[model samples]
Target: MANREYLKLDRVKGDLIVLEGVEGVAYGEILEITLDNGLKRDGKVVTVDGNRVIAQVFQGTQGISTSNASVKFAGKPLEIALSRDILGRSFNGIGKPYDGAGPIYCEKKYNVNGRPVNPVSREYPRNYLETGISAIDSLMTLIRGQKLPIFSGNGLSHNELAAQIVRQASVKGEDSENFAVVFAAMGVKHDDADFFRKSFEGSGVIQRVVMYVNLADDPVIERITTPRCAMTAAEYLAYEEGMHVLVILTDMTSYAEALREISSSREEVPSRKGYPGYLYSDLATIYERAGMIRGKAGSVTLLPILTMPNDDITHPIPDLSGYITEGQIVLSRDLQQKNIYPPINVLPSLSRLMKDGIGEGFTRDDHDEVASQLFSSYSRVQDVRSLAQIIGEDDLSEIDRKFLAFGVAFEKQFLSQKTDEKRTIEETLDIAWDILGILPPEELERLSPQMMEKYYTQR
Candidate 1:
């Protein structure tokens, strides 16, 4: 036990090491292993069963011989340094500085594996966080502590939409100084990373953003740590420093894939689509991290973006994520084909927390009604659209023709928005009423008489 420093690696398989005769090794403890080539590689203990310890080497075991390896446990789990200086900086998945600013000057270090928010201290999310996109702000509203994910497909503009939200998202009427963004991108392509960097910088929000990126070609094990590191930073900023943090993790599908790869490496049994059965609890570790502590001045709101495989929302990644998060914003391939800029299919997308976040004090007084009426009207628009496809539009009744016209205007005006456009909640609500006015007043069943009198106008 005293000579655990020179323990031999009993087995090596694809970035994983199996060693026996290790005493007192704990799970998640960092290890510095010296390879036979005199090169040092970092590893972390993933399992500890009596005297048999399994560890994952961060650097692949390319030139290592299992007979002559030296392992030293760091005596603690993986941790990251935290400071106010973390803002306006970029780092790789392991929290190493990548922005060329050198190492962060800080005295505080935190384990990347964060604990879930305690239920007693949890406050229900009620404050509105405006992203300035009409489709999101006016209908699928994002609250301060809610976890809402955006479900997209290949070649969709989810990246652009995510960038726009990071740029325009804010706590309405609150000063920008109190808000911050922690963006964690998992296994993204180089071009997508560059787009996010340029978009944040160009929008002048880069100063308040802390970005964590894991490129597609990087080590697959690092992908498993990226979001956890980002969430740890968000917790430090929000709970410790009283700064409202918006954490956006893009391409979560890649993360889940990484989990599957590691599970295969460990020879674990596969579940649906070769994913592990614990996928739900694994996702919960990330999604459940978002919330407002009862007495804290700051909150962590999550907006995770995951691309659906081949546009299938029923895929394991999205299916499990939908069960964990508050709600989802589903992007439509049909709308994308139509050349819509932000191609959000509003009918199927929803925010379950929309009710508690909007209304008199949080947003406009008529926000709830306006959003309901818009949802109802737009849903009917779908029915009319399907019917029009069966029986030609010219053969419809006069009122049906008016409904068809309203549907067209709704998609063109209310649903479609520019990438650079920033619409306030009030403006978004007004635009909804304006679009609803295209139909006769009787068609607006969801709107109250008071709202109709205030916003609705006779043709």
Candidate 2:
């Protein structure tokens, strides 16, 4: 006969949940909690074997014993923190305030493990999100209520790029619509967290910015929920408060690794490359949350960052991410090695929504033609580069040599920018003209004569 003993889990110390008769018991889905001394707790389902279940506690592992503690399962995963008050507030992964402001005076919360939204109810993403960066705006335009990822490698400046987007992204002024930023970083270093905090404050967007951070030193379990909590807050702000939101999740790779670790700890069967079997579905839950809901006044836009191992675009992280996201902004290690600050590889970077977001009224009449011309010119420059290497520079034709120079100038001028540099749409367009001036006016058949006069420089 199997003996059953009821156990009481009293507290959570860091990641370890303190309970009776179970030490080091892994916690799963966090259920509802009633706080002691007004300090709330979240529950998780730690183990399930042959109908026997065990859970670990969150918050602290102090003062819990067999006789005093009590627990009940709500038959669901941890409820997500979903409310309008989540913004401008900081929380650990388990939805506890690390900001020291105390418990949220809110009327509600929701399941953190989001339910699958009905596909038929999904609204098409039509609105535009204007990120001040020209390459992104002109080539890979970001649409409102879209999910995009920044595929970067080690030593890449994805953080700075993401920060720039958060600072600059807005909607067209015609409707006078504006958006808010919800930036969350998982498993980031202490200095990085401080940098982000200071960045939002210095930008004066801290009032509108909602930040959820799990430091590198924070328990891995926290990393798993940081982005989810951030999204939950974003959902509240956008869907509830009628605000457009740009949610930036830097280092999703860390989030994935954390999930894998938890899966291993729980002794779940691993799948591709030792990742959890449900990695795809788990990601879909988060990514699918960003979109326009039918009858909702606001939308959620997502930009997640994932660092590639050894600059491998084919790696599981970026590879799987590419399948899920609308498109990626690929950072170049070669460019970084060359001392390019931003290191954006424009050719490889793509914004799938570019076609829908850019047009005459949206940006300018020449936007499409200009972008195609730049793309064509840059791609051709690569051929010229290879030829230069083969035949030696002295053996190249005048035009071929000029094309090579243009490539170098384009990378250094357009792609590379100092971290502090901020350029408006007008400034970026003018600079494009300045660089295009090196090519003959006859070669620019993409633009009309009127455009040539208004935007082009006459030799």
Ten consecutive residues with minimal summed lDDT in candidate 2?
1-10
Worst 10-residue stretch by lDDT in candidate 1?
1-10
Candidate 1, which segments miss by more than 4 Å at Cα? 1-3, 36-38
**Residue lDDT tens for model 2, 104-181:** 766667666555668787788876787777677766778898898988887788887887777667776753344678
- TM-scores of all candidate predictions against the true structure: 0.97, 0.87
How accurate locally is residue 239 in candidate 1, as Cα lDDT from 0 to 100? Answer: 92
Q: Which candidate wins on lDDT?
A: 1
lDDT score at residue 412, model 1, on the 0-100 scale: 86
Question: Model 2 residue 342 lDDT?
Answer: 76
lDDT string for model 1 (102-124, tens) is 99878768999998778999999
Local error of candidate 1 at residue 87 (angstroms): 0.4
**For every candidate structure, what is the RMSD over all alpha carbons to the true structure, in angstroms?**
1.5, 4.4
